[model samples]
Target: YNKYFSLGISVADEMFGLLFFVLMAHTAYGDVSYSFLEEMKRGSVIGNIAKDLVLDVNRLSSRKARIDTEGNRKRYCDINLNTGELTVAERIDREEICEKKSSCVINQELVLENPLGLHRVIFNIEDINDNSPQFKQSVIKFEIRESALKGSRYLLDEAHDADISMNAVQSYMLQENEHFLLRVLTRTNGRTYGELVLNKELDREQQKEVTLILTAVDGGTPPRSGTVAIHVTVLDANDNAPLILPSCLIPGCVHIGYNITITATDEGSPPLSSTKNIHLTVADVNDNPPVFQEQSYRAHVQENNKPGSSICSVSATDPDWRQNGTVV
Candidate 1:
């Protein structure tokens, strides 16, 4: 009698186990996706997973429904079996997870036991403006020649933002100045950079150095910005010619064949000068008249001498040069 009773109990247990296996095998699978803003606080409700997956809310606890992140060390989310709502288990930082990727997604599964059921749950993480643009260096220095052309371009270091898409550095601004302007450029990889363009020519004589502020801005609401000081030292160029001024000098005596040197200097910071040698020559003028040694000429000649014969000659002197001193 005891052996027969034990056999009946074993058959009943096997039949119940077979029925449970058949019920688990008929479980349905589902796929659903939802979006949520990143940096949500812990315990924040994402959505009612039971309603989205078309599951009976009353049976959530009975079926032992839970969220499975596929062996992820950090459980980002959890399912409230009593309320049928999915809540955040840990704060999700989009930058920490996706790291510059345009799209951020956390793949999870809604798992149920007893009569096992599986549902794929995808969570799309959206970005927020929590980061500001930052430059590697606080001050950037440049040495530009004063002779640079108006359209010359100089590449600048781009600002870095941890946030992706619109929250990243979007544009650059240059302070109002006469010599330089700002131009924004895009890269093939969808990153943006800045270019300092020479909108006006530079003159080291006028301005030896220039200080400008460069600002990088993000496309967030009430956008955040970063600033870098640009210290540009205008290098001197030989663009200016030397200027010579006219002047008169009163000297006691000046020789007819004197050499004079003239120098011209420019208005550069380190002034430049040029020298020229000039040979002076006196010109003939009618300012002096012939005069005798004794103020009167004395000539002794024979009355019967020939017209071209020799006679006692009278000489005169003039303190003039060249043709003006000729005593003919």
Candidate 2:
């Protein structure tokens, strides 16, 4: 049966171009597998299915040889009757089809009529380095006390890649610096993550903040990577005691009856302080004398004024409120 089919196909190929076919199938003709890179262009030739399955190319037109994806709504591939070649009907993006699966394979069936036959065809969609590792956030922040111990580990946001296997994120790199370093860890589930380790103690007064870059990289050739900025804020810790100076000068206006409070604080994380209150009361001193309204006092009386006769009155003024400025 195979020999006769091949002979007919050869003659048809020499005459009219092999064109068009229908499918009839109940008999299984075994499975055929082909490997292809992901993201193949539409209309790209995959393989000659008729040749692989030892089918009659001539019978394709009369018997109707076609492809079926088990009632799939989107057909990814098609069979060309003229050349018996299987080709991509639409673009095949492995990431869209299989997501994070370790391996991606598309199953299809090649069917033909006449005697009726079914051949299983498998397409192994290999991964390509088309995706870069990505973090959920652009920046990560941390707060540590100035007294924080060295070798402290801070978990970081894990990077994700759409592509799997060698194309997925495999390692991490932290920008070189004295205060921190990067540590890559693998989970029991075969997944990887990153940690930031503190290599030195922080001093809030000397250096209050630090920034570093963390990068996630894949193992693909000409690797791709994503980065996130790490910001660390060093909090203060109580480390110094309050000190009192021998003497201090008071500022601003002060009166004899005024009260004042003095506070002293230390430059510590949580500062220490002391306070003192003062009150004052003293006797007043006379500083001004009374003044007459006219520099020289002049009074006039009638030519033969009698004793105790009334004369022009003399007046004096005092500026002080108390007896210190009184005129007698």
Candidate 3:
């Protein structure tokens, strides 16, 4: 009875083993597997890193799974968040691969914007405090009429501080000098001026050009400074007097028909001050009475001489010549 019971148990065990074998073979036909374990391992690595960094694993998985499940019509790749690296999972067409080999992958290293590529991806690098403010031009120029009134604002060329806002411009400063003084001139047009004031009225005769040193300081703590030389020129003004020549002395009236010369000069600016030869004309006055060599000359007395006959010879001398001389 014991032997028969043992034989029945062995047969039952053999039947159960055959049924298990058939079930496994039927399931194998539907499982089209190609290293799913390796893919799962790769997926877990990315998923774990994303979890640690609090990134979206679902989004990354969706992007990767799209190509994994469907053979890369859209050409997808997997990124390992843990390593900050990319792995190409499926390639849509042969053109997607550089070498056309099974392992050739698309590179997605973060790079600057490129104009030539057809498709691109960008990752922005957050800025860190890096650069100091700098001026575009070290020197700038402006022209102002030297005749410009005192306290009149003459703005210098505005400087550009290239540093980011709040770091770019500090208050503008003028160097200590006798001739130049600087001030800030703000306007409604969004333009600010580094106004330069002339300490004294410019005199062209004294100095044609005036130079001043100007500086720009950024508002940054321990401010940065830039300096430029400013040149201002004084223009000429026609404000001078005409010069007069000294009077000439001549002997008075002894010689008849004597000529004397007089001149005038100017002390004014050029083109106005140059001397021109001008003759001085003097009119004779009756103050100088003409004198005769002798008061009268003896002549033959004839009782019957014509009433108008010359009785005596007379002569006189005049001190002046031409229109100035007179005979009476």
| TM-score winner | 1
lDDT of 3 at 23: 42
By descending lDDT, how would the candidates be arranged? 1, 2, 3
Error of 3 at 69 (Å): 24
The digit string of per-residue lDDT tens for model 2 on 1-328 reads 2322465476686432222131212444467999998778989998998898787787788778888775464677899888899898998888998998888888887766676667777899999999999999989999988888999999999999998877889999999998998889998877799888889988888998999999999999989999999999999887545554535444333465677677888776467787777564444456557888988867766798889987877778786546866788
Q: Write the residue-wise lDDT of candidate 3 on 1-328 in tens digits.
A: 1222355457796665554544444323332111111122223322232333333544543333111222222423455533433344442232222221223333222111111111122211111122343346665555555566777767676655544334455557777876567888666743345888777666677777777677766655556767777766566666544556646544343434544443444443443543445444444454555778887677778798898888877788865555556676
Candidate 2, residue 213: lDDT: 93
lDDT (C-alpha, whole model) for all candidates: 0.83, 0.80, 0.47
Error of 2 at 138 (Å): 1.3
Please estimate how well model 1 matches the true structure, expressed as its whole-model Cα lDDT: 0.83
Regions of candidate 2 where Cα sits further than 4 Å from its true position: 1-26, 243-328
Residue 30 displacement (Å), model 2: 1.7
Ranking by TM-score: 1, 2, 3
